[model samples]
Target chain A: MVTMRDVAREAGVSKATVSYVVSGSSLISEKTAAKVRAAMEKLGYSVNHTARALSTAKTNAIGVVTSFRNNGACFDLSAGAYLYGIAAAARRHGYDTMLLTGDDGVEAIRSAALSRRVDGVVVLDVLIGDARVGALKESGIPAVMLGSPADSQGVDVVDSNFEAAAVSLVERLYDHGHRSILFIGWPEAVYERKLNYAVRFRASLMEACAMRGLRVGAVYAHDATLGASEVIPRALRDCPSATAMVIHNDAAVVGAPQAFERTGIRVPADLSVVTVMPDQLGEGMQIPFDSVGIDVDAVASHTVDRLVERIGDPEMSARVELLDQPMHVRGSVRAAHED
Target chain B: MVTMRDVAREAGVSKATVSYVVSGSSLISEKTAAKVRAAMEKLGYSVNHTARALSTAKTNAIGVVTSFRNNGACFDLSAGAYLYGIAAAARRHGYDTMLLTGDDGVEAIRSAALSRRVDGVVVLDVLIGDARVGALKESGIPAVMLGSPADSQGVDVVDSNFEAAAVSLVERLYDHGHRSILFIGWPEAVYERKLNYAVRFRASLMEACAMRGLRVGAVYAHDATLGASEVIPRALRDCPSATAMVIHNDAAVVGAPQAFERTGIRVPADLSVVTVMPDQLGEGMQIPFDSVGIDVDAVASHTVDRLVERIGDPEMSARVELLDQPMHVRGSVRAAHED
Candidate 1:
């Protein structure tokens, strides 16, 4: 149990010299190094593996910071794919991924960077004016966010084009002769937290509504299943003339058809639905949803690739990349009748 | 840039001494420390943040290694809860969680341990005879596995009671007067890989079936949805009189009833189905299967707790814990009759 201190004392040298000689990290004269080596032999001291790793190369690990709020206290289906994608991409880059879930947010991110546990950070579920972006920038650690904020001051971001999808969905319904539509958005907490995607999509929705002179009512829900209970009844009460709907919540997608069935409102016959979701839910319904895909894997790969590039060149200019949003307008929409 | 070497040279001290004086990782005589400090003032050498971190207390970070396989390189609904559970527990204990997904399983694990990136590791989706167990043991790093392996030589393990669930399920089917039953298991690759849960569950199923003198046939499929296609036709074609089925595949669970409906088979009228899954799927189905619950949160908490305890005492003998297996017998099973 000889400590490095004992070795230093035996060698009659400073502790840093002993470390330098053992790690081969710093330039030391052969004579001084020989003395440190001999002292180590005499004391039978072993270097900690951490010191050994630093001598050869970096940890070769990356940090991925996923929002604790995204999954709440338990699991959420949405965030899982993005995290898995990032890990797979990191592995391909010969780096292990470490998921950092710190409830304290920016401070926790600062700790991970300062500790040198990871080379760079990938922040998921990015919000506007995120404190972690500022923290990562100030620390000079390379970072990438999965969503882009309105202000791209110091952070690299990658996101899906939710704005385009929103505008197009609204416009497409308008062209199909639907004037009255109801928009089912995420819970108020999403926009209240000022997440980039939620805010941007809502803005785009409003822009389209204004341009087309369409009458639209918006509502929010937290749970998809229970959300439908509120969405259906409220849709009828608030926008009774509505003939089309643009839905954003996945929970609502899974529950809305079932809810409509119980309420005696059939898809296309009473109301048409367009949504952003995976194809599995869309294909399973009695009437499939006209849907836009969420390319989580593409988002993960782009974010990781950018972070790796930034890690190699810490001084590189930060950039934002948004993947194209593609829509699959299955037979969920129909020509609307005059109300 | 002025380096620690410059500080050491000016102070006429070894590099380790400068690091010791700056990081304060080790004690030095006040006179020697003062000399190094004066050299730092003369050379204007600033300590890097990494060195600054080691000067403080622990990093307060724990590494959780999840097999990218669990999520299937993207997203799998199954791995979500386990990961979410681990993150929640780590937060409660004031430990930041780092997810490690290594394509090279043992080497990646060894890398994490040797680099000193984490205080401890929580490995998920553990396999029997896993090389990581021996590697972690030899390295003397505190580690825990979500599933116990066949050999518990050095590492601690915590898992859901899959074996108990399997045995109980088979025995219950027998109690319901099911003499001839068909057993549908996970893909053969799961067993071929020697995963502890799959191997143990199948073994327990066999043991229970043997004791009851019931005739059972087993089949395996990779995809759960398509698995129903193969399983349904194969079961009745092979066993012919299999009045009950024990299903363990999630995809099969989601798809089997739909398959049954298309084939015009009524549940409990034509065939009985018993499964081990979350209640949500069963309750939402056309016919709810007799179900057994998987307590992923409990397993995650147990795994994290042990890793934390081991981090506090690396010398503690390793242990394995299995949480309870709870079952809900919906009306999916009925008394078997001689046709």
Candidate 2:
């Protein structure tokens, strides 16, 4: 096996320089980094992961634990794009990802980080009063949470700014002269479990609507097709005075138009609607709608950067991150009383 | 940390027996497995992964690489549910999974498996003449391909039997006295790139149609709204005599009913259709259709089983496995000339 000394000699650089390049601890000039890489490739210096891990207490790998939220069944998932973002970002730092699944994310973190298989961990879909966040606080591992947790002061956290998204989306409708709007939020079970985003979005939506003198009607919609079909029509019927709808549930929105159509409600003609969802989901819908979209790539970039930074400097305090979620108005909203 | 010897002592078993339990090499009795697990939990033996990996030449983690396959952009991904199955299975085996992305699957395999970061590998949506398969063959990594490759002799292969599915679906339609069929195949580029499933399904459908003395009108439809809207109706017009439709493209089928609806063609009245898709995708569609489904759980279970078996015994020959895909007849097919 080629050693670091051999790589340093081949590149005419110091051992520390080679280490810096490999570990990504400090910024090396592109020229020097290129030279180090070429020398390592030529000398066949595949880092002895075990040896290096022991010396630096760092593994060029990030632990990512994904949690699926559905009924008891966890197979109904959509974390591919989100994970693709994190993995792409990690690869840029020459790091691989260790994936751990199942609901017991706290245990996965403990095993992976305690065993030194990963330098730090990135957890997805963090909930309020998250046990994983508590586990991280206890483990003292350099980590980042992709979803905002309830108590995230001391931990690195990045979220899509759903609080702002909810407020702005409703404000947009309020400015458009809509007073009474029905809000389709995540299922009651999701809020009961305290997924931070779903609960926070509802609170912000209601508060912002109130500030703008708007009457708000909030209802829960689960992601399943059957759940959406049953709940959306009921919500529409319950909110006869509402002239607009703001949907934060992606699955519900997929079937919401059909539900509305079956109830003899015309989209944008009688009631306007905006959504909080990914661009792809909105684009695939038969009824075009305005949306505050999740920028997965940006979220991934920020997450990896924070995790890498934490790994490099364990003493650094946690960060609060908010991603851009611009609303794309696509003719889904109309003036109130257009009828 | 509690050591392996400590676990062995607590379990009242030899250290080697404990190792066998951890490595999953031998079929330790259920009673023994339970005792070992209980002891490990009691003593908190999380297993020093790096040391164990070095000693046993096993990481107890399988490497999974994903490649996105839609027009140059990689987001048209469906590998999530498939991966969920694998991760769920790996957890059952007391192992975790390592994920790598980008189109450089060949390199990911070379580095991940060669470095012993993973005991084996699983590649999804394999193409003909896949470089990943070639790299695995040369590297001697315990691996399996989720989709069939052109040269699969020396590699473990597990694929949803799309060829059999196409033949059976078409034969069922033909049995109902439908002699003229319109087949909407995958995009030309997908077939040209030689994705095994697309090419094989098309070939099988054509051959089966010929065997039935049926006239087949084939057209390629890319998974895009524009493509489906234009191609489906055009194919319907061209195949005026065709009474049944077979679609292998998921995206095209999502929009096909609307296309037919616009052209004054009523489903199962003027035209009957069957699709090759996942049950979830078909269930989410506006127009209900019969479907031959890919059971992702079975694929995941089979892929993980073969890879684990190979990891336990490297000399084992490559195996070919096919998953059973039942067709769900959902009122999409009707007798020819019924109208």
In terms of DockQ, which candidate is strongest?
Answer: 2
Candidate 1, residue A165: how far the Cα is off, in Å: 2.4
lDDT of 2 by residue, A109-165 (tens): 887766878888898877878888888888778899988877885999988999999
Clashes of each: 12, 0
Scanning candidate 1 chain B in windows of ten residues, the lowest lDDT window is B278-287
| Cα lDDT listed for each candidate | 0.73, 0.77
DockQ for every prediction shown:
0.19, 0.35
* Per-candidate TM-score against the hidden true structure: 0.71, 0.84
Q: Classify candidate 2 by CAPRI docking class.
A: acceptable
lDDT of 2 by residue, B230-270 (tens): 79888878878889999987656655654664566777887
Q: Taking the tens digit of each residue's C-alpha lDDT, what string does model 1 give over B1-339?
A: 467888899999999999888768788999999999999988656654344334442445677776646422112455655666788788788776766776666765676665565688888767878877887777666888888898878678888888888888888888878888888877677777777777888888888898889888998755433346556776778888788998876556655654565556778888888888644333323226777877666767878888889899977887778877689867888878865
Question: How high is the lDDT of residue B233 in model 1?
Answer: 70
